[model samples]
Target: MIYQQFQRSPMQTRISGPRAWLAMAISLSLICLSLFLLPFVLLFGAITLGCLVLFSRVYMARQIAKLNQAQANAHQHDHTTEEPHSHVYNSVNIVRESNAKETHRMRQQGRTFEHKEDEH
Candidate 1:
């Protein structure tokens, strides 16, 4: 509906004198230069991308080695006999404690409101 009432102004189509010639010449020169340098630009881009990929691979290898060494050290220093399920139980207890604290605070602030749906 908004677009149906909208009106656009006419575009200018007339250009004369030296300004028009200058604009044409500049545009043509830019087009020619881009065409001439396209191949060189592509070649440089490929070389740079290859170098970046190689560098990333080497960097990732170094990081993986460091991680492996750290894991080995951690294993050597770990002497606990606790089972993994103990951690889950501990996390659940922590969450319960946090929720209790939040509920207590909310009650103290008199904001303990419950929403109920109306039934016909």
Candidate 2:
């Protein structure tokens, strides 16, 4: 039962700091054995880490923005069917009256949608 509780190490945890630096140090020492290699190793590692951090930050920011937009859309959807739709709240549902306005706008724009069946 005690042995059953133990699991193998995760792949994500495998690519860690000390181990990664050890691997890098070995590779760096093999390529260049000078004492000057330490500064380069540390600098290169820092730059690599900074780039990964920045990339993840940008990706997370976009994801959060998309989530916030979806939340706003949901909130707008909640107010769609209520009376005085635009003038009162500017919510999106706008049952009969808003549809008519949208239709009028579409006619003015001269744009239409057509759905096609996929051959696959």
Candidate 3:
């Protein structure tokens, strides 16, 4: 069997710095020229679009976080619906950290150690 050497294409190059700026400039120039003929311009419509974009981003972020948390909990083999959780902190540096680590003790007999949100 003959072995083939695969090479990455120019199109697949990582975008950064000058390359990214050049691409942006080209795209903006194209859009400006192409869309110059479009007649109607409304400030209300622009504002509405901006608000919709902001709301959608916030909504999607919340949804993604919820899904990730559920997936993480599932991976840790979380069984019960009502789990007793506690806010814990390192005895030394309570002042530095604002977000407390949640401590969970598995009620089941086989599990001995503290089961944090990341149960594994």
Assess every candidate by TM-score. 0.50, 0.40, 0.32
Q: Which model scores highest in lDDT?
A: 2
Q: Which ten residues in a row have the lowest lDDT in candidate 2?
A: 88-97
Candidate 1, residues 1-120: lDDT per residue as tens digits? 667434643332356578888998999999999999999999999999999999999999999999999988776655355565655344334443357878667656876456667743
- From the highest TM-score down, the ranking of the candidates is 1, 2, 3
lDDT of 3 by residue, 56-118 (tens): 999999999999999988746643443567433455435443443431222223435566996
RMSD to the hidden true structure, all candidates: 15.0, 21.5, 22.5
How many residue pairs clash in model 3?
A: 0
Candidate 2, 1-120: lDDT as tens digits: 766435655655677789898998899887776576889989999999999999999999999999999999986986785476345435343444456787668766996767777743
List candidate 3 stretches off by more than 4 Å.
Answer: 1-41, 78-120
**lDDT score at residue 34, model 1, on the 0-100 scale:** 100
